[model samples]
Target: MACMKLGSKSDAFQRQGQAWFCATGLPSDIIVEVGDMSFHLHKFPLLSRSGVMERLIAEASEEGDEKSCINLPDIPGGPKTFEFVAKFCYGVKLELTASNVVYLRCAAEHLEMTEEHGEGNLISQTETFLNQVVLRNWKDSLRALQTCDDILTYADELQITKRCIESLAMKASTDPNLFGWPITEHGGPMQSPGGSVLWNGISTGARPKNSSIDWWYEDVSTLSFPLYKRLIAVMESRGIRQEVISGSLTSYARKYLPVLNRHQVVNDSSSRLEPVGLGAMVSEEEQRFLLEDIDRLLPMQKGLVPTKFLFGLLRTAMILRASSSCISNLERRIGMQLDQATVEDLLMPNFSYSMETLYNVDCVQRILEHFLAMDQITGGASPCSVDDGQLIGSPSLTPITMVAKLIDGYLAEVAPDVNLKLPKFQALAASVPDYSRPLDDGLYRAIDIYLKSHPWLGESEREQLCRLMDCQKLSLEACTHAAQNERLPLRVVVQVLFFEQLQLRTSIAGCFLVSDNLDGSRQLRSGVAGSSEGGWTTAVRENQVLKVGMDHMRMRVCELEKECLTMRQEIEKLGRVKGSSAWENVSKKLGLKMKSQMCSAQEGSVSKQKNGNGKNRHGKHKKTFTPDPEA
Candidate 1:
């Protein structure tokens, strides 16, 4: 026998003969009969042992284990056997024999015994029997029913039971082929109760021909959890309208809100509002109210509409808000305040339409004047300072200079027939008798004379001629020379003069022939003698003179050719010498072998000059070396 100490304060015990008991705190030591040995147990004082007995009983009851007896020998009336038996019936039976001293071992053994033979055994046994029956009889029935509807009906009819409802629900939800049959009006195990299933109130068949039973049932709002799950499968399989499905979910949520709230749904302080899906159903008035509320909530409410539908609604509302006379005067006043606020928003710096207002020349001029006045008040430069020396440096003021440049640019853009508001100075000049002196007098006179004399010249040609005359600063003398010498072929004279000035060999012979004095006395004697030689002889003499001119021209051409060839050769030689990389080689050949010889020579010259200067400071110094004869 082993002693069992069931107490708040634990103490060891030893078996004596056939009985042992706890020494610390126990109401009584129980009697034990191991094999053939029977012994009595010791009982402790009632007051000291009541708490320990109570705790042990409570622990045993909580563990649901059996209580056994251990007898000891130091009690007032030995041990109480019936008390131990009663404790075992109501609480855990912990064996205290030496063979099994640990409480856990005793508890485990008791638990196994209870599971096999106690009251809990009935439930396990029934579940096992039911599972076996379901497997044996309802496997085919379960497989035949593809949806929750068929399963429920079969369960109701007693052909099958709820034992396989879990498996059937999973199959109905996941199996597309089985789930697909009930949705598409095909022959299947599961069929809706109504012969015609309604979709948006259009009834067709026992099952939807084009959609699923789950989709039709989504609006029913009275589906069980398993049926609802199966319905979702059918909806997904049939591609049911998301809006309808979401609306159904929202309706279900509202229906179950009270029950959900009991489960501490609203207890979370952090959760502010519940989010509803976009597909949820809503009335037009409710939707408008919601949109208006959202607009009020948003950061940028002025231009924003809650939804596309709300856009037109809000626009109509705005129009009504603006013009509806039915509104109370107080409401109208509030509306006016809102209108002012809206207008202020439209007129805000970030959203201004003022920039859209067209800016005419007057506006630009006003802006310019404002800037000018600001600049003047600040002692800063004006914005449009046309004569600011730093901005546009003082220009040439000569009438001809101004006429050639400024007037030309202005006139090119300006129409002579149109009246222009000229500058003050220009207007003042126009008031004088010869106000347009340079342009109207000299430049215009020259242009007029040229165009009148050259009537065949086009406008463009005349303009170009005038422009050239202006650019070249041609005086009257130059113009007169150009015009009078036109008969003398001034172009040829100019060409000859250019060649002569350049001293070019190519034009020397031609120049001489043109410059020959044929009207002189020597030319007259030769011509008369040549005329006496008959007409043919005169022609021959003329031909001979022409031949002499040609020969001279040919000789000059040959000389020019020779000179060009010589110049080309000289240029080529110079290029080769200049481009050659033989400076080191040349220096080496000159026997100036030292690498730093040039530097050393320069240093030596400087040192000698310093020494000569020192010597000259003391006495007259004469140079000894003579200059190089070859150099």
Candidate 2:
């Protein structure tokens, strides 16, 4: 067989012992060679321009084989080109091809470099390197921060601590020691007074005695002699002025003295000497100067130094004590003044005006208007209950009391009139037993009992009662039904049933009567029954007797009704407002047109059945009856 084709579109040819084939469709620039057998392939023009062809050619050349048929993998054109080339190629490893290597390199570069490739492993390696660099160079970063002149100025002006300075500097440099000078040398703790020329003797050269050098020496000795000596020598050699040295020494002393004193006290008790007293050592003029300095320092301390620093110094005792005591004393004096001022201000009319004044004025006017309205509504009734001189008078009682009386009068006036027309009670008693009399008496008695039981009720109870009575009207229909159907007599029935219901409804109301006789035989007394002399005593007794008599009469009527149900039923049916003569009378009185019918449940049903059957008792089909809708 002719050399078996590796790809379908490849042209088979032979050279030496290996098959040499050329791919029909491959990029021109991609020249593939395997062991002296060469295959010239051309990629798509776009792929060549896009560098894909150049990449393939480069990969193929690196393999350096020119004898075997070269296989062309799939390019951007299609798999047909790849299959065509593979079929024609021979004597070559099928998998270890130039195209495969080039594809893999492209994939690796794309996957590792582009954000869309999702190369988490590569990203992790990059982040780790960055973190290590930052951590390793932290000291350098801190030093860089301290190089800022603004930060140095702030620290110096505020007289900040060495630790604070170091911390600030460390924020910017990896090696903070790069900027830090050794503390033990170069004007540090290692230098001493005996060997250090600056500290051994005072300057005695031709420098003016009262000039900058003298002032510097004074400041150095006054603040911290040891540190001052070292600082003086460093400044003197560096050509710094006496005033500058003095100011620096003062700043250092002010900032670190409290901290040093605290450390010294803890380390050596004997060295913990009392602070020198300014009052005892300094003159009045010097004291004035010190106080001025203190005031100036207070503003600096407010923002820079922590308050704990000041409190650490025992020397601050006098100032702290004076400040606290003065504040407390000033508060007491102000409190006294405020108390007297409030009293004095209240006594002056112009100084005292509030919403309460307006409220009170409005309340008084409203009260007067209310009383006048009440009097007008009551037909100019007298406020007093009785004309008796011995009894306490009711002189324009409070609104609450007025309301109570109004309810009593209204119920009394309406009850008798309504009760007279009730068939159940009216047939038994000639006068309806003055149900109002018992009602009024019981109500008043209940109020009196409530007051006695709960003395705290005082004016509030009256107010509550007044509100209950206001705008309340008796349901005349309900009262009539209750009187008739309840079988209660006009007298005892009204009290036992009606008023008892009311009492039960309101737990706040107390007992209705104070009768010692459980039998109710000792002549039921009315609370507001008696007239002038016997002081309502006779009226009270007469009212009670009348109530009892009405109750007895109601009992007789009930007995008679039980003996004669027919008679009672007829009487009830006739009296019912819905279908009876009474209803007709009421309708006429109320100016309503009437279409009367006998009202009975059975009668109504039978009428409906008859109508539905379309027949009457005569057995003849009757015309369907349709009652008037208006009726």
Candidate 3:
């Protein structure tokens, strides 16, 4: 809220003549000047109606030498609005119109006119007018807001921006498509003033201007954060994409800049406004100031800020897409939340998207650090653990899935994006096991980079990497990746190179399966990951291996797939028929659950793997130092 600080009051008995006060038909004591108009009214009414005025009169009385009249020039409410306020105070009933309502509301609030006092006071009457008439009708609300443009400095003092935005946000959420942007037009470079660039990698700035009136963009920028956040949640619920939301909000950072007052109309039939535009961004100094305000919010109120004025003792953190410090506060708040959580609340999509901005801003290392620390304190598996690969929808997997998704997105979208060339896949690779690998070409690329950089990692890691290379999992690209790898152990290379040939044969038996739903997409695994699997690269790999060097690799994959299928079938039969000769072998192969052990079932079952790739195994790769020529 902004205010005038409404200066101190004084009184003197100079006795400015009672020209207007005499017309009131009552004994005139004081003449108040507001703008060009003079109100000749009794001091008692002013004393009773306004607390501020009463205090001033009391102080003036005690000062001895005093002006007989109070001259209030340039009050927040202009003469027209004051006329209505004076009439209301005199017990006169006037029809409330959209044009005067917001102004009256602002004037009432500034005068400290109490809302609880009912319609007798301007404040209470204004509230009724807004709720019952203005806000309920879109046209009426628009009209009310149009009236506000010229009087923003006054309206802002009364915190009217939030109310106006709430009404407009409802209209926006009702039909987001009405904003009239083509899908292709989105994600355009967000441009600032003078053709300066913004959202440079991660920070965002402003929306470009055009001849067409962009009402939604303008109002969205004018709103305070609480109202803006509500608008975001509403728009999202309407299924509007977050990119559009982020793009629009880029203007929020520049809302404080001054703009031209050229008359801009709202709709064809109705109103006009000041020239509307928010530049790309504020200076670095303002960014820190605003973001610090948000950062210094208490832990609970970081996202949940409540408006209690005394809370001002707290520091302010900047709150903008471009403010690094603003982001750090949120990251710290998240860390605090995780420390106290009973379950995997961090897996929530809202939380994920909040962090996405952090990633876009290139602040994810701090995020990764927080989650890892949480994992260490929690000792691995969350309280709500997923069983084995047989179960789906386990909350425990949410954290894992979130991290997997983060890595999957990093590998797929961020790493190769020209603006974000992050090359830290080695640490990300080591964070999760290969069996837990989501399906994506980036997975293959990330793993390839990690292995190439750490060639000395021992046999165990190479073996896990081999399981990740399962024929079904391998796109032609993934296959080509393995073929190009000079570091794979002898046995692992044999498994990967031979996969496609084995899959063709193995699927004929009931042993190999690719889900029909999944078959159309990830033909190998997860939705996000499997989208780019094996089309061009796999086709080329098949030809290269057949013509030159795949004979031995094909034979090895075939033998391995055959052996695993036979052994699995034998184990199933042994479980069915007690006393079968293979019982001991099967039992040992599928380790028994000890008393303290729990049954683990993994779900969202990808197609059943024909090779023994379904088996769960976890291990860190051993490494021997190999000197790099550059080092």
User: What TM-score does candidate 1 reach?
Assistant: 0.15
Off by over 4 Å in 2: 1-291, 298-302, 309-631
TM-score per model over all chains: 0.15, 0.14, 0.35
- Tell me the lDDT of candidate 1: 0.32
Q: Is candidate 1 or candidate 3 better by lDDT?
A: 3
Q: Which model is ahead, 1 or 2, in terms of TM-score?
A: 1
1-631 in candidate 1: lDDT tens per residue?
A: 1123222322244446655443434444444443344433332221122333334345544665444343223221123332332223333333222112112222222223234234433223323333432222212213212222422442334332343344333332343454342353423334322333434444322233443324322233334434444445455455544544544443443333332133444434242222212223234443443333323322222212222222222332333332232212212222222212221121111112333322111222222233234333544332221221122322322322332232223222221212222231132222222221232324333334434444565544543444322222333344334333322222222322222222323233333334344324335776677645465465445545544544443344444344334333433444356434553343233222121222332343343333221000111112122212111
Going through the candidates in the order shown, the clash numbers are 12, 48, 36
Candidate with best lDDT? 3
Task: Output the worst ten-in-a-row residue range by lDDT, candidate 3.
Answer: 595-604
- TM-score result, candidate 3: 0.35
In terms of TM-score, the best-performing candidate is 3
Each model's lDDT: 0.32, 0.29, 0.46
Look at candidate 3 and tell me the lDDT of residue 240: 57
**Model 2 RMSD to the real structure?**
40.8
